[model samples]
Target: METPGNEERRPPTVPEGIPLLDEEAKLPQNERPELLIITGMSGAGRSRTAAALEDLDWYVVDNLPPRMLAALARMMTPGEGGVHRLAAVVDVRSREFFAELVSVLDQLRLQGTDYRIVFLDADDDVLVRRYESVRRPHPLQGDGRLLDGITEERQLLAHLRRRADVLIDTTDLSVHDLARKVREVVAGESDRPLRLTVVSFGFKYGLPLDADHVVDVRFLTNPYWVSELRHLTGTDEPVRDYVLGQRGATEFADRYVDALAPVLDGYIDELKPFVTIAVGCTGGKHRSVAMAEAIAQRLRDRGQSVRTLHRDLGRE
Candidate 1:
């Protein structure tokens, strides 16, 4: 569980600004490997995201000092930790250590080490609620309201957020939703089948900002109108039957699949790895969920790897 270079002998204080690499990094910069920086707001789900990456075979480092990133990269070896892919979960929790991020990024650039940053974010109100629910003070909150701490943290992270390679807004996402985003973004070519995520969401909660493909299924019948199925969700047999059994419901799935073939093909041909399809209805409770399931099954039948999520299944 030791992070790369974490327990190894080193100076008590790392030099400010530029990163210092060990002897292993002496080779020309062109030989460097891949690195993923997982950072962002304190309560925006960095822990869950990092855990998801670990499940996907990444060599995960928690709370690693930014200044030691280069050394850690250089120190990673297949025999020790199988660090072909390195993901470091860092945040503002380590105040001084985190301050060295900009300089460390510059060093990585100079070393030609490919790097991508996944920035996790959420709405202020949502963040406050999450903190309250957990009964934990915000990391930036010293002697003020939770909102004050959130505002301060947002200000601190504004710069890094702008530079993020992937920005995930978790304001309304479930843990599964966030995990799917993490998996899709980090999956290697070998795990390409998971390049697509099919999710069901309620338009009332707002569109899933992480979606690359937005499909509105509101045109379909509203199962909520039928009192008998109103309480049931898309996952339920009666609700699904009510939704898909409606006119043009099954047809829509068929035609949509045909229409998406060329688009999916183009993404694959262009080497674009991830796609999130958001299916929405008035309430994510019924119609959207069932259609999402049907569409996901169609894609699966075609041999594509896909995970279906109902973002507002019970929020109704």
Candidate 2:
């Protein structure tokens, strides 16, 4: 549906007098360095997938309109300051443009662009349950039943699912597991460094079993039991000092860091994809939050890109 004279409607061949024309110039012309198309069901973990790709040095574009795929892909190529690896998220959220993705992808293929489609999926029940638990409406739902939106999305995405080079069923996989799969698929022929994430959660909500490493801080003091500090988080100076002041807290943290430092350092040396360190406490508000922050800072001091998430912090 492009206009006959639109700028994006240029001839397939690179025009004459383009200075950067070369063998490498033949690569996909992208606006960002790498272009990724990320799309999936509302609860199917697209955000997590995008985050993982971002961690792996992929330039991630989230919730992109499907109509913009071809243009975005062109912009992500070499001459356009596009990085070589790009990931984008497209989904039901793009109500009108979503239908154009397949055609755009076809155009890319015809143009010999190097791209991959990753489809993240989960069982219907799991997705429904996730939506219910999060209290968030499905993207395709518009004054209709939630399941109707889910059904419509499934139908809409059927073609993409069939065409996906990688299909991940996240019903049982932890975020770490999903991230590992993403790393494996997208880490081809690249020398970029892997990024590590440490996610901390409360055991009350259940440990983040997807964590590559799980540390228990329940052995530390339960700030929830303290009337004065009950409402404060581990981010608070008093809570942090109080936790560190515990008899075995410092020792435990030191030994834990020592144990992990070598492993993480080795992972970097081997160029492994990514590692998630999960820390748990009785409640997400106090101990786990403190431990996660402490460990994140420690890793940062060691010169690593680290992200910390307190999964259960704001949950009821």
Candidate 3:
């Protein structure tokens, strides 16, 4: 099958930065192996995305040549306690073998195999900065400038990018954000329920870039000001009581969770399994910690999956 970018013909525009799958993405339930092809620009967070999928219990193979994909897919056996979710990182690292990818993908579809392609991308400037920060040369750069390598790669990947089921733009995404995006794309593949992570952070330490929602608890009285609560963390009984005892603290927690009700429902409907809600205050040790716990508890009480992390707790 001829790819879209050949003969100077433009490919149909697909959705970008979201998991809007193509019509072909919906495979009939059968014995075919499930596969995810991870490809894109070298500095576009493919490695990190693969790591995140690994953490999600996916069987991840990094820098796999295009030819090996068929063999790997043949080995996958669904519901036999074997690797069912196979994620292969195929890219320019395969050199000339990479050009065989489009044909291989077409063959997979023709064979009725279930697979989806996720292409990661970033701005040229961001790609250049990433390579320079690591003091590494771009793979295709040879003796040319980094921009030359980026341009070469973009041209090489244009067709795949257009054909991808999910196109993630990592120009401004943090590692955690990228991981969350990965989760959003593959969440439906697993039986796990939606998981919410409530992070307690200090505003002074900077915002949590992966946060889906940020709540400020600075309006509450500072526990540090209270002589007895100064040395105790929010987990301590006295500190917890002190912070929640504030006039509007409990009300805020209840109302805030209520406000997030629709948003959480929307995430579940959209198959986004991971959510990070950050609670911030002057310092992470006191108000933020208490409020995060309160919010997490509310979520748990509603039978939603919840976990808590105190990011800046020990910083002070």
Predicted model with the maximum TM-score: 3
For candidate 3, write residues 58-113 as lDDT tens digits. Answer: 89999999999889999897765778889999999899999999999999888877
Query: Which model is ahead, 1 or 3, in terms of lDDT?
Result: 3
Question: lDDT value for candidate 3?
Answer: 0.88
Q: State the lDDT of candidate 2 residue by residue for 71-121, as single tens digits.
A: 777765455444667788988787888888888888888987767787888
Relative to the true structure, candidate 1 has a C-alpha RMSD (angstroms) of 17.6
lDDT of 1 by residue, 155-207 (tens): 88889999999999898888877776776665443345546789999998999
Off by over 4 Å in 1: 1-32, 77-81, 188-316
Q: Distance from true position, residue 86, model 2, in Å?
A: 1.3
Each candidate: RMSD = 17.6, 14.4, 15.4
Q: Sort the predicted structures by lDDT, highest score first.
A: 3, 1, 2
Give the Cα lDDT of each candidate. 0.83, 0.78, 0.88
For each candidate in turn, the TM-score is 0.50, 0.53, 0.54
- Residue 119 in model 1: lDDT: 92
Candidate no. 2 TM-score: 0.53
